[model samples]
Each structure stands twice: as C-alpha cells, then as structure tokens.
Target: MPHIAVIGGGPAGLRAAEILAEAGHGVTVFDQKPSFGRKFLMAGRGGLNLTHSEPAPDFLKKYGAAETLMARAFERFSPKDLVEWCHGMGLKTFVGTSGRVYPETMKASPLLRAWLKRLDGLGVRFCPRHRWQGWEGDALVFQTSTGEAVRFTPDATLIALGGASWPHLGSDGQWANIFGKADIALSPFRPANCGFLVSWSEIFRTKHAGEPLKPVTLSFAGNEKRGEVMITEKGVEGSLIYAFGAALRDAIEAKGKADITLDLRPDLSQEALLKRLSAPRGSQSFSNFLRKASGLSPLALSLLREGQKDLPLDPEVLAARIKAMPLALTGTAPLARAISTAGGVRLDAVDDHLMLKARPGVFVAGEMLDWEAPTGGYLLQGCFSTAAIAAEGIKAFLAPA
Candidate 1:
C-alpha cells in the first residue's frame, strides 16, 4: 500500500485521511495544533451547520468564480453525499428552516469523536503539533511540538491547510509563503464571510452596539438577503451581512467602500407603512408613536436613525427611510477575526482531479485551494467535497498501471 501524508487536520484533511485509509493506504494525518479539529469545534459552538439542503445548481453558485472548479468536486461528493456520510458514521442530521443541515445533537463533538474513532480503527496514524515547514529535497519537513525538526518521505502528499482566517485556530495562511517559495501559483488571501466596518456615531455606537436587527432585508450589488444582522462595536456582522460579504469586500477593495440598503421593516410595504405613520399621535412621544406605528424594535429604530439625522415628520419620507436605510461600509474587519477567507492556491495550479500540475502527486483540497463560499453550511460542504476529490486523485496517482 502507498504511504500518503495528509497535512492540516481540518475537515478536508481529516475527511481525506478517512477515505485514503479506508482504501487500504497507509495514511498519516498531521496538524499543527495539539487537537485535530479546533476550528471545527469552534464552528459547532453556534449549532454546527454541516451543509445546505438546496439543489445542486443553487448550491454550486455560492462558490462564485470557482463554481466550475467546485462543480467537479461536488460530482465526486455533493452535499447529499456528505449527509449520507454523516449518517454512515451513526450521526443523525436534520435540515433547518433555512435549509442548512445540522447534526441531530446540534454539536460537532459527537460527530468528531465518532469520526476519529473510525479513522483510528482504520489504522490511520496522527501526528499532532506537527507544523509543516516546507520541502526538504523530496521529503516533507515538519517542526514537532518539542521543536525538533523531522522529515518524512511519503508516496504522495495531500495539503488541506485552510486559508488565512481564524489564525488562533491554526489556519494562519503561512503555508502560502512555503508554496510561493516552491514557485507554485497562488492568490493573495482576503477576508470572506466577515463583517464590514461602519463609522458609527458615538451616540449610535453607545446605544446599539452588540444588538441585533431581525426580520430585515439587506440589498447590495443587485443581490438581496433577508435575515438577522448584529451590530458590532466596530461594524455589522451575522448571517444576513455574511451573505453579501464577498461582494461588499470586493467593492470596498476596489472603490474604498460599499453601500448597502437595509430594510428595517421588510414585512411592511412602504405604502402600508405610510398609512400607519399617517395615524394621529396624541400626547405620545414621537419615538413611541413611530415605534408603535412601524412595529420596529429599538435596535431597528436606532439603525434607521443612524442613516437619518432626524426622524422625518413627513409620513411618506419616514416610510421610505424605514423601508430603505442606506449603510456605508468603510472596510472589512481584520483577517484574523474573519469567519473565513478567500484566495489561496489558484485553481489553475491544480488539475481536474485536484492534483497540483506542477508538483505531481501533491494534491490540494479545502480552503487551501482558491475557492470560497459563504458561511451557511457551504464552507464545510466545500471542504468535504474537495477533500473527496483529492483523495480519489491520490488513489489514481499512487496505483497507476
């Protein structure tokens, strides 16, 4: 059996290790961290979203520019395949109202534990705290926890080191330097599915920071998403904002800023809102009167006011403002704090099977590749699908006739 080395123990690395080991290859999984899945566990803290239940076409579009590259991987292991894989490991999964899939237990610990046990049963060896340095001749070099450098010569290698995000979780994008030194083509990393910075006034920041705006719709670049968003001390984040993260980040990069329109009351038509606002207010304060009329929470009211210096008295103007509150995002949050990142090894650097064309037998998978997707279960699904494709590539490369 061919001895294969799978580097980086995120979802992609671990999943590829499982596949290669089960295929009767000698697989060794290595991770820089002491544990195998730090980010995976962190992702589960907010009810692990495993994958989405959307149709393949819609799901594939989330990858944006990399849709063509991801299409092949999905054919090898789609979201439905991922769900079945979870079931095969004795874990039950359910689809959320938003169509995102989650484990029945709603946590990653159980699923991770079961997965590790299966890999162990398959005789897969793990080397934790093995920080990959670079190539030493034809052998891979690693710095162990003890600061001792070691070398390994494997029949093939699969790299699944994640992109530059959540540095504390071990995906620091330091691998880019090594790959660059190796003359491999790469794309600069940028924060994705992250918050955008908004210059909030002192009063607005003080009052609404850390609050949530719900049942709202945000429109930008001709795309709209209706969900909840959180107002951070620095800017805005959460599921709603993340849907437009890539576009906003790109716009800010090119034009120094991006403007998005937020509908504070998506459920209410502007005309209906105007009719309600036209109602006579007796002794009640204007704030209370508007609050009751629009049925907006204090957070939504504050956000609406952020765009308008003074709440308009004209019912039509106020209704229009409530329906479309413009927000200017100055920049994106720091890469370290971003939930995920885009741009890595250029897809052109890898063949259709995910093997690096320049370096035969070296396969790339997961976020390490150039593709990126939004937060809503797409990230994990992308990792799994790519890993599966790379594993098949490794098998083909190892046992060529």
Candidate 2:
C-alpha cells in the first residue's frame, strides 16, 4: 500500500483521508493544532450547516467564478451524496427552510467525532501538532510541538490548510509563503463573508450599533439579497451583508469604497408606501408618524436618518428613500475576523483532478483553492466535494500500472 500524507486536519483533509484509507492506503493526517476541527466546532457553535438543499445546478452556481472546477467536484460528490455520506455514519440530517441542510443534532461535534472514529477504524493515523513546513527535496518536513523537525516521504500528498480566516483556529495563511517559495502559483488571500466598515455618525453608532435590521433587502451592484443585517460600530454585517461580500470587497479594492442600497420594506411597493406616508400626522410627532406609516423599526428609522438628517416632507421622496437607501462601505473586516477567505491556488494552477500542476503527486482541496461561496452550507459542501476529487486524483496517481 502506498503511504499518503494528508496535511491540515480540516473537513477536506479528513474526508480525503477517509476515502484513501478505505481504499487500503496508509494515510496519516497532520495538523498544527493539538486537536482537529477547532474551526469546525466554532462554526457549529451556532449550528453546523452541512450542505444546501437547493438543486445541484443552483447549488453549483453559488461557487461563482470557480463553477467549472466545482462542477467537476460536484460530479464526483454532490450535496445529495454528501448527505448520504453523513447518513452512512448514522448521523441524521434535515433540510432547513432556507434550503440549507444540517445534522439533526445541529452540532458539528457529534458528526466530527463519528467521522474521526470512522477514519481510525479504517486504519488512518492522526498526528497532532505537526506543522507542515513545505518540503525538503522530495520529503515533507514538519516541525513538531517540541521544536523537533521530522521528515516523511510519502507516495502522494493532499493539502487542505484552509484559508487565512480564523487564524487561532489553525488557518493563518502562512502556507502561502511556503507555496510561493516552491513556485506554486497562488493568489493573495482576501476577506470573504466578512463585515464591511462604514463611517457612521456617533449618535447612530451609539444608538443602533449591535441592533439587527431584519426582513430588509440589500442591493449591491445588480445583485439583491433579503435577510437580517446587524448594525455594528463599524458598519453593517450579518447574512445580508455576507451575500454581497465578494462583490463589495472587490469593488472596494478597485474603487475606494462600495455603496449598497437597503430596502427597509421590500414587500411594499413604492406607490403603496407613498400612499401610506401621505396619511395625516394628526398631532403625531414626525418620528412617530414616519414609524407608524413605514412600519419600520426604530433602528431602521435611525438608519434612514443617517442618510439625510432632515426627513423629507414629500411623501414620494420619502417613499423613494425608504425603498432605496444608499449606504457606503469603506472597507472589509480583517481576514482574521472574516467568516471565510477568498483567493488561493488559482483554478488554472491545478489540473482537472485538483492535483497541483507545479507539484505532481500533490493535490489541493477546500478553502486552499481559489473559490468562495456564501455562508449557507455552501462552504462546507465545497470543501467536501473538492476533497472527493483530490482523493480520486491521489488514488489514480498511486495505481500500479
């Protein structure tokens, strides 16, 4: 049996290890952290969103520019396949109303525990605190927790070091430098699914910061997403903001900033909203009247006022402002603070099976690849799907002629 080294004990690495080990290969998973799946556990703190329930075609669309490569990955292992794999481990899964899938336990611990147990049963080895340090000739070098350097020569390798997000959880992006030294092409990492900064007035920041503006539609460029947005001291965030994260981040990189429009009442037509605003105040204060007429929360009203201090008296103008309130995003939260990362090994840098073109016998998967999707289960699915492709590539590479 050929010895395979799997670096980075993330979802991708672990999944690949399981597959390779099941094929009767000797597989060892190495991680910098003392334990595996730290970030996965953090992600599951709220709820472990495994994969999306949308049609495979629609789910593939979320990968954006890397759809071609992701298409190949999904062909090998799609979302439905992913859920079935979970069930194979005796983990029950349910589809959310938003079309996102989650284990019935709603926690990553149970699933991860079961997965690790399965891998161990398949004769996979786990090596914690072994930080990969590029390569020494054809041998892989790792610095153990005790500061001792160890080298291992394997028939094949799969790297899934993740992206630069959540550094404390083991994805610190330091691997970029190592790959760079080896002449492996990679893109500069950027924040994805992250919050953006805005210059909010002191009063608004103080009063509305940390408040949630729900059932709001956020429009950026030509894309629109309806969800809840959290008001932060720096600007706005949450699922709605994350939907436009890539576009907004790229726009900010090209230009100085990106501007997004927030529709407080997406359900109401402008004409109907105007008609409602035309109602007589009848001794009600301007704020009270606007609040009652627009059916907007106090936080929403305050956000509207942030655009223009003096409320417009014209019902039509007020209605238009409510329908499309522009908010400027100055910058994105730091990569460490982001939910995920964008920009990694470019698509063309890897072969059809996700083996690195510059480094044959070595494959890449998960966030290490240059692809990003929104938070709703797409991230994990991308990781798993690509891992399946990489494992296939490794198995093919090691096959005896």
Model 1, position 189, has a per-residue lDDT of 96
- Computed on alpha carbons, the lDDT of every model, listed in order, comes to 0.92, 0.93
Question: Residue 391 of candidate 2: its Cα lDDT?
Answer: 99
Collision pairs in model 2 = none
Clashes of 1: 0
Candidate 2 least-lDDT 10 residues: 300-309
Model 2 C-alpha lDDT per residue in residues 1-401, reported as the tens digit of each score: 79999999999999999999999999999999999999889999999999999887888888899898889999888999999999998999999889889999999999999999999999999999999998998999999999999999999999999999999999999999999988888888999999999999999999888999988999988888899999999987898888888889999999989988989999999999999999898999988899999999888888889957598999999999999998999999888999999998988899998999999999999999999999999999999999999999999999988
Off by over 4 Å in 1: none
lDDT of 1 at 280: 95
lDDT of 1 by residue, 117-206 (tens): 999999999999999999988899999999999899999999999999999999999999999988899999999989889999889998
| Total backbone collisions for each predicted model | 0, 0
Q: What TM-score does candidate 2 reach?
A: 0.98
